[model samples]
Target: MTDEHRSGCPINLSLEVFGDKWSLLILRDMIFGAQRHFRDLQKGSQEGIASNILASRLKHLVELGMLTKRPDPAHKQKAIYSLTEASIQLVPVMAALGSWGLRWQPASEELSIRAQLLEEGGPELWNRFMAELRDEHLGIPAEPSADGKLVRERLQEAYLAVLAERGKSLPSKA
Candidate 1:
């Protein structure tokens, strides 16, 4: 990473951190799919990211402070990746991008359901989801919800419902 930046604009600065084609998608997999290992991320990506690209992006994201990588205690040769606070704060941005994609892009219904809920739920949902992400990733406690179900669970349920409606099999989380 170099100190040289094209411009001082916020968008430009943010893009410098994650402007590449693969960075945000890697973050998306970590956030939505809970993929913490290199193999999981490489295998789970719908776009089928190549191993070298995945490795390079992971290093870049960690260097940018958007993610953390630590040795996994469970496996001797494996490392676990986790989203950092900076990346967790991108929920709204992700929501807005999803909303735009859903509006203008040809998106699959089952794949786009979470974005739909996030769009409809608006800031309220985004805040709650961010709180959840903070709790999960940063060890910050989020206030208890009235309904008790996790925000992710609700999103997953909606996703499953869409898959069921389409008669598609559930994709393995592994």
Candidate 2:
């Protein structure tokens, strides 16, 4: 099927890329789950997105300019996919979705950082995080390279810290 989508409204335009369950879920894994590659996405969710679906989503997101795949410096077979400005802009959307899940969803207690995500970093925090991401990804209002860290690297670092705080180690690099 051809992707003849409505460009009338910004929301419709956005839904063209992120309308489906798997698409946003894939994006969420990138944003919230620290998923930079296929394996990171595959292992975490209990709902178990099929590999074929996952693969398709990855490609689709990349095609729509939401993600970019870079050769993984650490692994031969793996490619590290980072969110582009398009995808990073979805941070607020994700934060709202997360807030909803935390509030009404019955599976609240099982979530790893429900309290932090919901209270400590709701829309305001999501915006700040997105600002940092935009500054890093799109070079918005450019900042000095004092740290040499990109938005992608900063995000990965933050995810690792969260994992460490929860008494887990970053999954060993393969």
Top candidate by lDDT: 1
Output the lDDT of residue 133, model 1: 81
Model 2 Cα lDDT, one tens digit per residue, 58-82? 9998898998887988998999888
Q: Judged by TM-score, which candidate is best? A: 1
The residue pairs that clash in candidate 2, if any, are none
- TM-score, cand. 1 vs. native: 0.93
> Runs in model 2 with CA error above 4 Å?
1-3, 112-116, 131-174
lDDT per residue (tens digit) for residues 7-61 in model 1 = 7888999999989979999988888777889999998988889999999999999
Off by over 4 Å in 1: 1-3, 171-174
The positional error of residue 169 in candidate 2, measured at the CA in angstroms, is 14
